[model samples]
Target: MTDIHQDPGAATRQEPGATSRRVIQEFWRLRWVAVAVALVGSFVYWPIIDNFRVSLTHQDIFTGETSPAGLENYRRLTEDPVIGLALWNNLAYAVISVLFQVFGAFLLAAIIEGLGSPRARAFWRAVYFIPSAISTTVTGLLFYFIYQPGMGLMDGVLQGLGLGAWSRVWLGDPDTAIYAIIAMSQWQGFGYAALLFSVAIQKIPAELYDAARMDGAGALRQIWSITLPMTREMTGLMVIITVTGAFQVFNEVMVMTGGGPNNASQVLGTWLYEQGFNQNDMGYAAAIGSLIFAVTMACGLAQLWLNARRRVT
Candidate 1:
């Protein structure tokens, strides 16, 4: 009987020196990635772990208020009615912004995708992306004037067109302030989402389109099936980006509304800023910060889980 160990395939597997050399080569080739990952992790964990420790064990490091808060701050998050309202408002704002930005971006990207010449595509892409080039502070300020009651642009045009009844105090009224801000964020953010889709769409093989056309798929049908399905990974990533960005919105609020008209537009980030900077309630504000961090991390992990599942397929 032939010895199993002496078989040709077994000899190939037993090439010890080759395997060792390959491992060594791979280690050297990938050593920089390991170093980079380690360096990045150190910074990430330092702040997260430190912030968690600080939140749980509040010490006035400067003013001597160190007295193991022991979940007091976290407990306050649930019990404080204002905090609850602010958090609910924040959720509402994020949902509104994400819905508008992602949906608008996807629509715009779809309209422009593969339909334009290279020069025309670049032109519209730049046009859409132009607002994102402007600082959020500047854009907020610009829109602040645009929505002014009578002296401003919209009001001016409305007054000119005898559509005075349609115009309202866009920012002054609580009923419309958050929605207006949502529009501003969407306007600035849509370009980013479109650019991401554009980059991903470019990599899709043109042959796929040719195949779809041969099957007599109309542009809309082709988009629903071929374009969107193939770009599901990109869509998931863009949704995560939109959601995280929505949560972090602060600059526009600071410049235009300042969570004003009696906290009508109070999102979590704005509330945290108001507390920490305005009220000087650093401890309480830090708790809000922690919550924001948690929400962002949850969204990130959800995105990761989705991506992993797609890979498994």
Candidate 2:
């Protein structure tokens, strides 16, 4: 009251010190959390950074000697025909996984969600998801037996059904090896995707479906109009996860065909493993690992961007 015409300069002069003190207090409060995050980040990222650095140097696996090779490892990777084959296989695997793992799972989830009884839904979900619970190595070995030439379960079924002519060496043929692995992968993985989609589907409001039904929408129409649109985010997520997993396929190839039949089923993951462990080309393997990391990150980022853009629109 006495200083009704207070100086604007006085308020301005006090503002900076107040802001500085506030910032200092906030930092003090969060100092331990910041320190912990930094420590964890350093621990987690040091190996990745070291791998990138190692990719630039030639390292003797037996003697533990390393020499600067610059981009020679990347050059070798570019020129290698097996690398090209592995890249193509990875692409094909990703496409198949997107189709079956993501889309197929959506269909399965819809079917399960449509069940009249809760017990029936639960039973079918468990049945479908049981295969995913089995170890990947065991699944690979089991499929290896099923795809064995002339005497496996698949061939036996073909014979029993009077389709013996259709039978062949599923995992041993150059033409069918990768496809067989893809099929096995789908059988093992699609259920997990289905379970995820089912959960997402459940989160969608029942009122939406009721409204659609009131509007005389049939089952298929309701699914197309309401279910699919509602699960768009989940579908995008599944695509990202499936594509990433497909590109990193290894355990199945290792256990089923060992990237065999003249490397017909080779994927980047198995190729990297072979280069590092078997061939002892640590630098080349590191380069391949770096490439994989780059590709996977790019794909995931692109997917996220597209989804965000869709939402914004």
Candidate 3:
């Protein structure tokens, strides 16, 4: 019998090589993730940080001079009456959008989904969604012409229906300008919202409805007990999106009323544009942008919290 012995240090020497290979593999794996993080930090997070920095200082466009303004811009935001009007206008947009786009669209979707004929359901969906597919600029311009005081179709129809006394310059009058713009937005937006609600409704199990029916549930009962609860997530999402979009509204107001008739139709987005580009107040504009960011972020955090709560429960 012959005794064979292996060098004990050989195993220890190979362990270091194995460890080195693992370290290299892990480095390679994380290299791609590092690239993504770097890109996002540069494009997304850096801009946000830079915007805050810019908000603290005033920049002159023509003179190309930059000066620190501290909180003066934000102080002006508190005193600026136009800012108050813009906030009110955005609030109206959010409230009306929630009413029509969220609740109303959900009802519309339920009704459309309830129809027996597939063709009818498809037809109605297409009709409603058509307006959403149209360009906002084109839609704004189209509504602008339609809202013209004397020559527009709206006034003409009022006159033809013997309701001429009820007609006002839809886009010209300060009292009605923002509302008119809001109405146009609702008309263009509700269809898309309805389509989303319809998709959510479709995802619901038919067995739930069948079970409800067997339990003596009517259409309204089924909707209340089954549909509403099932689509709660979708409804929450729509509310957040609608409110955010309302605050960010710019194009339609810009194209239709130009925030005119005394800036009655100005929303946060348009107000920011007016401050930065038109009025040449970059610092003030940055502050408005920060406010918008805060609001949208709050909505996003609310959504996250709701989702977490739902999961926990």
lDDT of 2 by residue, 116-195 (tens): 89999999999989999999899988998898888789999999999999998899899999999999999999889999
C-alpha lDDT values of all predictions: 0.79, 0.90, 0.90
Clash count per candidate = 0, 0, 0
User: Which segments of candidate 2 are over 4 A away from where they belong?
Assistant: 1-3, 15-20, 29-40
lDDT tens digits, residue span 167-212, model 3: 9989889999999999999999999999999999999989999999
Candidate 1 residue lDDT tens string, 6-110: 566764576558988989999999887997888877887677777766666555535757557768888878987767766666677667766766666766787
State how far residue 55 of model 3 sits from its true place (Å).
Answer: 0.6
User: Clashing residue pairs in candidate 2, if any?
Assistant: none
C-alpha RMSD by candidate, in order: 4.2, 2.1, 4.4
Model 2 error, position 296 (Å): 0.3
Candidate number achieving the greatest TM-score relative to the actual structure:
2
Full-model lDDT, candidate 2:
0.90
